[model samples]
Target: MNEIELTIEQSKIYNGVICPYCKGISEMIKSKEIYGKDYGWLYICKPCDAYVGCHKNSKRPLGRLANKNLRKLKNEAHRYFDKIWKLKILDRTKAYNWLSEQLNIPFDYTHIGMFSEKTCRTVVEISKRALNDNRRLDMDFGVEPVTEFFETI
Candidate 1:
């Protein structure tokens, strides 16, 4: 990533977050609390069964805690969205820029981890549409990601 891209990603570092589902405070606990095995830390809301993973080796939450349904949507969103850059349709940064433009969201707010269900659906829709139109996208941009996105998220 360039200095500017690095700066943008670093700017939104999430230290802690209120649970979006229940409006409760999330607790930072070992991943085993929910995963049945230790992987890393997770910020979670017990009553609502909502949770979000943290960045590796950090106490900061990745994003807002998600309920089960929203988590599924996030996975689907990633599946489609990742392909755009993975297949070299556009360079990772440009792929995100394209998504940002298409979604009319700012580039800094474009990560799928922070998206709501509605936005996740839109991401899937647009990503699928873009992937289907990959040849044109490849011809149009002919670029793809400098670094891998977070897999645990």
Candidate 2:
């Protein structure tokens, strides 16, 4: 390829950074799975990346969109709610006392009559599990070899 062509190719591949998890540069892996159907970011390994050739006409990213959004939201919410959640464990009595006073509920500082402790506990446990699972993928490179599962059109 000519120098200009090489530069263009380099620019396209370098447009985005590599996956923090696997240290792979994001690339537009070719697919025959069709346009919208074959959508997604593919992080290629260093050098040629050696992605499987696609006979189909489509491609897709392996990462979950929801997980990305959740991470962003979690980071933002942590700035505000981290204290409350920490207080919840370090000084449950004090946290509940503050809640009781702020809400003007009939419950006293000692009694958590205003909230369903069971329900709250369940929600917190489930949320914690979800967060843990999500964090596991924080450094994950998602799926590799876009051509492996590329649905042939």
Candidate 3:
């Protein structure tokens, strides 16, 4: 078998997380440098304008650095997926676990924050399918309607 070649971004030996745009190791900087207020720390690629926020007050990045388009996709994925738990269809942890199975990714790496654009799109498609399935079940069984269920919760 041939050996698989890893790109710079895919390699684990880099000193810091790679920027999706520039494919360079990112620099840790204050969020205020980009946001005008110190939201927290971030791993940033200044030339590419790609960045990822750190975990709360730490230097640890929440996920890979994303550009504007990736950021949009990530937000959209979260918007749809969050509803599964928000509507009590599944608890937050179970919802993530379900997403992990749907995406065929390991549970530990299933976070939307860490997903690429393709994965984010998959998340949106999976969530829409799940919501539709729930609606169909509700209708067929004459159980609580989807709209009413949301209103009551």
lDDT of each: 0.74, 0.35, 0.77
- RMSD versus native structure for model 2: 22.5
Worst 10 residues of 3 by lDDT: 144-153
**Winner on TM-score (2 vs 3):** 3
Best-matching candidate per lDDT: 3
Estimate, for each residue in 1-153, the C-alpha lDDT of model 2 and write its tens digit. Answer: 112232543333223333332445545553333234553443343353322222234343322111233334434433322344452332645554544444444333222211233423333344344344434444364623212111111
Instruction: Identify the runs in model 3 with alpha carbons over 4 angstroms from their true place.
Output: 1-16, 141-153
**Clashing pairs in model 1, backbone N/Cα/C closer than 3 A:** 90-143, 90-144, 91-143, 91-144, 92-144, 92-145
Candidate 1: misplaced stretches above 4 Å? 1-15, 135-153
Ten residues in a row with the worst lDDT in model 1? 1-10
Ranking by TM-score: 3, 1, 2
